[model samples]
Target chain A: MDSMIQINNLKKTYSNGFNALKGININIEKGKFFGLLGPNGAGKTTTIGILTGLVNLTSGNVLIDGYDVIKDYKITRRMIGLSPQEINLDVFFTIKELLTFQGGYFGLSLSESKKRVEKLLYDLGLEDKVNAKARELSGGMKRRVQIAKALVHDPELIILDEPTAGVDIELRHLLWNSLKEMNIKQNKTLLLTTHYIEEAEALCDEVAIIDDGKIIAQGSPKELIKADGESYINITVNKINENILSDYNIDINENIIKITSKNPEKDIPNIINILSESNIAVRNLNVKTASLEDVFLKLTGKNIIDD
Target chain B: MINTPFLTLIYREVLRFIVLYKQTIMPGIISSGLYLVIFGHALGSRIGSINNIDYIHFIIPGLTMMAVINQSYANSSSSIMQAKYLKFIEDYLVAPVSGFELSMSFIIGAIFRGVINGILIILTCWMLTDFNVHNYSLSLFFLIITSCVFGAIGVIIGIISKSWDQVGVFGTFVFMPLSMLGGVFWSVDMLPKGWQFITILNPLYWMINGLRYSMIGISEIPIMFSIIISIIFAIIFTIIASVMFSRGYRIKS
Candidate 1:
């Protein structure tokens, strides 16, 4: 599949001599939920700002559907919609007005903008709040309005920057489900920058882990988990003792004792005894699957949130 | 397609001012009313007449236009500047609207509010002092266009302001003194020769003079000069505003 957005050595430097994006390159596939997964200030938003034309690029090129961002801004922006990280919708305008205005900004005719607003409100589950002023809506409702406004142009590629930053668990699930269906049923390409790892893992088809103005890793969620072939067996015995668990080919790595094993079921019994007899103080332990968090930790030697 | 985008932005800007009527329009009317009641009644009696018209009658057009320009410019300029300071312009920044379209919306919004305030002030003047507008056409023309001109200036102010406090500085320090000294309470013909030359330099001085001429059949400067200055300043202010907008000045960073 052709990339929806292609970055060729894109770089961005701020006025005060801060290099926000340093020689970055990314290829995002069409109709895929791609995550620009990184912590705040890790160049995710800066990269996005450059792509959306809110922040100018210092050097290099960004192509959306083969059109350079600066050279062909009109067309590139026409095909893209962005819901910024901040919830900054106009407080006075109604939900319908917000969506209608968003459609208008894309040069859509009044009748067409009206129809698009209706469709967006319905799809985003904001049909009830159509006439409600933005300030009157609940936080979740307002968030949905912001997203609805973004989708008013019927953009094929949608970029949501930390879309769930201040939302709750239930509301987040609702939003994720809506986004999931949009990508699946409409074949919309989504670029989601989120701090929520588990949410990204569930929604994103592929993830690019960026740190310190660079992409450290990029791949499908499953591929990333499998590519990390080794699994650590974290065992907590009935008793407390790190030296005893080491006899069963186990290597203790700070905090908890660990052993590299293909199958933990076979290794758990032998490791459980040393803790039970020696009373090493068994607190809690479980063999969890290697996730994107572990991948980030392995690559950067620090948690994704930290970097 | 181009016009649709333009209309969309203007419609939103119009809706913003009207929807926040208490915040944008009412304050202007109330402030202008206080000026009429306090100054028109008190000073009109003491100062008597200027060029055969009551002081209350002579100052009406200037006061009305001043209020119109003040509110119209403030509404648009502060609305956008606050949006910028709050970092909300990012919504429009990420949208597909062109710079010209965005600038048009803001300028038009200011014009709308200014015209509305101008009408209210004229109506109030008629009610308060029985000052019948002698040339209705000129009054309407001067009222509408002057508001548009100053409104454009407001957009430039919005684009240039880095903080909300800067907005206050412009209003309190610059616009306030210019309007008060621009002859909202007096006439330029009454000033000394040298000060009269300085008054001719103030764009609002001509704007108020034009509106004043329309209302009372009297003008310190010729009506044609006033109209020419109003049009010239409107164009200049618009070019300045649209240029700042097109460049994305302080906003795109």
Candidate 2:
């Protein structure tokens, strides 16, 4: 499959001598839901900024639909729609006006822009607030307007930078449905960056974990976890007895016992039997597979959701 | 064929101010009126005539030109600065619009506001006092070129200014004093030799003189010189603004 976006050794060094991006490379396949997951200040936004031409790349090239971002900006920019991390919108313009104007910015004619604006307003559930000022809308509504503004041009690829940030659960689900519809039904290629591990796990077909200005891991969520090749069985008992754990490699934290195993199917039942034989009342038993979070922790030695 | 991004940006810029007309237009009109009433009445009698015209008549052109200058400057400075402050300028930056297109859209929007304000002040002068436009075509020429000059200057300021307070400082310390000292209330001949020499160094003086020549066939300097200077200054300010836009000063990361 042809790539919708191909980044070749992209690097960005800020004036303050901070190397925000250090020769990172990525290729997003056409019509695929790709997630770039990272912690804060992990070069996710910088990469997005360079892709959208907000930040200048220090060295290397980025091609969107086979066109260089700098040499062929007009064609490249027209092919990608960006929902930035920040709420960069005119507060005074109405929702409909923002969409229409964004369409026009991409060279859409006035009539065509208006038609697209109407459809996007209805699709995004902003029909009732079409005439409302951007500042008047709630935070979720503002985020929706940003998405509508990005989609008004109908680009081939949509890049969302932290689109669900600060949104409530219901709004997050609503956005997820719309995004899924765009990716699945409409066959639009998506490149999303987020800190939400579950969002990446649930929606993205391929995930890339970037840490400290580098891509530390990349694969499907399940494949990434399976490739880590580690599973754990957690058992909560009424009391911990050191004599019972003498033969097994187990971590005892208060009344909880955690034992790592290569295979959970064989190890979980054995652990449960040992707990039962020890006369320890089993309060809880959980078999944990390696998740994307665990994979991230193994690769970077840091949690994904760190303040 | 699709319309250019420049066209859309211009439409957006003009529409932005029109939607906020009370903030953009009303203050300029009210201030122009106050200047006409207070300054015209207070000094019209004491300073009887300037170069064979009444003080009221002489200052009408100045007041109208002043309004054009301030409005032109304010329109672009506030418009572009607001986009930067709110980070909405990224919309244009990420789009296919060129630097020239972005810069020209702002300059054109500022010219529109300046010309509109000029017309309103001229109409207000005609209705309230005995003011006449001597040469309609020449007046249009001066109004447009002078507005363009200030509009370009505004775009330059807008690109370089980092804060709203910086914009306020420019208006207060730079634009306002320059306009007042540019012979808005009095003629250059009334000043001493050294002051007259210093006043001629101000660009707004030439702009005001050009407008006065257009409105009443009277000026502190030769009409040809004023016209040439205004056109030259317009070109220079436009080049400066265009260069700033091309460099993405304070705009692109």
Per-prediction TM-score:
0.87, 0.92
**CA shift at A131, candidate 1, in angstroms?**
3.9
The residue-by-residue lDDT of candidate 1 on B172-215, one tens digit each, is 88878888778988877778989888877777788888999898
Docking class of 1: medium
Number of the predicted model whose DockQ against the real structure is largest: 2
* Model 2: reference contacts kept, as a fraction: 0.80
Cα lDDT, all candidates? 0.81, 0.86
What's model 1's overall lDDT? 0.81
TM-score, prediction 1? 0.87
lDDT by residue for model 2 over A1-307, one digit each (tens)?
9988899998889888998888888988999999998888889999988888788889999999899998898888888899998898887687788788899899898789999999888988889998899889899999999888789899999999999999999989999998999999999999999888889988999988888888878888888887875777788899888787666668889988888876678777777777789788889989787678777788878787883
Task: Compute the lDDT for candidate 2.
Answer: 0.86
Clashing residue pairs in candidate 2 (N, C-alpha, C atoms within 3 angstroms): none
